[model samples]
Target: MNNRLLTAVFIAAALYLSGGFTHIAGAEDGVTFIPKESEIVSAATGKSISVKSTCPSGKRLIGGGGECTGYLNTLGSAALTINAPRPDEGAWLVECTNLNRNPGEIRAMAWAVCADAGVLEKNR
Candidate 1:
């Protein structure tokens, strides 16, 4: 029930509600969501780390998110400074800083939600 967990839950719920992980029924717009995940990175106290999830070829990034997990620090848990889509790079970037002063590890992962470029064009 920490900040990081709450943030992750919130993101998951939002994605579920928005159908970011499912195909729409009877919709033949050729729009589909492809999810990608980065390898987990662990950071020590007072350290920072960054990770990215890149979409496969022919896919463009639409949305993304990240997660941080570990023991809480004196102030709080690790902070997510960036959780955004990198359309130019066709990826999702995630950065986190470990504010914990004690001895522990903070792990982070990046998630990318991608779709056909044609879908993006249609929406635009």
Candidate 2:
């Protein structure tokens, strides 16, 4: 097991030194992975607001996360998620709802991680 680990590390080091993994997604080769983010805030209290954010051309969504913010110590929360349909498209959807039935506004944010479309092609 130890020998296998050592071998893997040595191979990675060699590849790095040889410039096999030096180019970024935006480089001339366009083989790097870049992260994309999107966010949406709710306007009305006690109501659910959904928002979607899209990625740029030539990019694909790989991962995502989200969060919600509302009144302090109040019955309010948010839900966020990622919507990825294809390698060329992705969206961040956020829903904020108030449970206290009060006049308050909540905010929801979603983050989407995107990568160069070329990266996907290379792997396949």
Candidate 3:
């Protein structure tokens, strides 16, 4: 009886957690996915990408065909994650690997969402 109850508990927990799993519908994300501009970039591979303060502020490229191409090829898919930094402000963390070619320059004003948010509005 105890074993059966334990199994039921485990199943309940799994279902509860899995129920919250989210799927981004209709979002197109190629390798090295950056959903918005001005997001911090990954300095290294196989690790959590971060926000780099060094990114230029005046609407310029962030990561240009940099070393990211090395890791992008290793990944089959990537996610463009957004973290809220402040109220009405957020930053992106992206991981990219060039499957066929080198990564081009990066900028905070690169995505339509960034323009709508007014973070990269001036560049638009």
Candidate 3, superposed: residue stretches over 4 Å from native: 1-46, 51-68, 72-87, 95-112, 116-124
Model 2 clashing residue pairs (backbone): 25-32
In order of appearance, the predictions have TM-scores of: 0.63, 0.49, 0.20
Candidate 2 Cα errors over 4 Å, as ranges: 1-45, 72-89, 120-124
Q: What TM-score does prediction 1 earn?
A: 0.63
Judged by whole-model lDDT over C-alpha atoms, candidate 3 comes out at 0.28
lDDT of 3 by residue, 21-108 (tens): 2521111211121333333343333333423222223222212111122233245222223322221233323333222234332222
Sorted on lDDT, best first, the list reads 1, 2, 3
lDDT of 2 at 29: 39
Best by TM-score: 1
**Residue range 30-115, candidate 2, lDDT tens digits:** 43233333233334545655444555566566444344555511352433322233434465454445545445556554454455
Clashes of each: 0, 1, 7
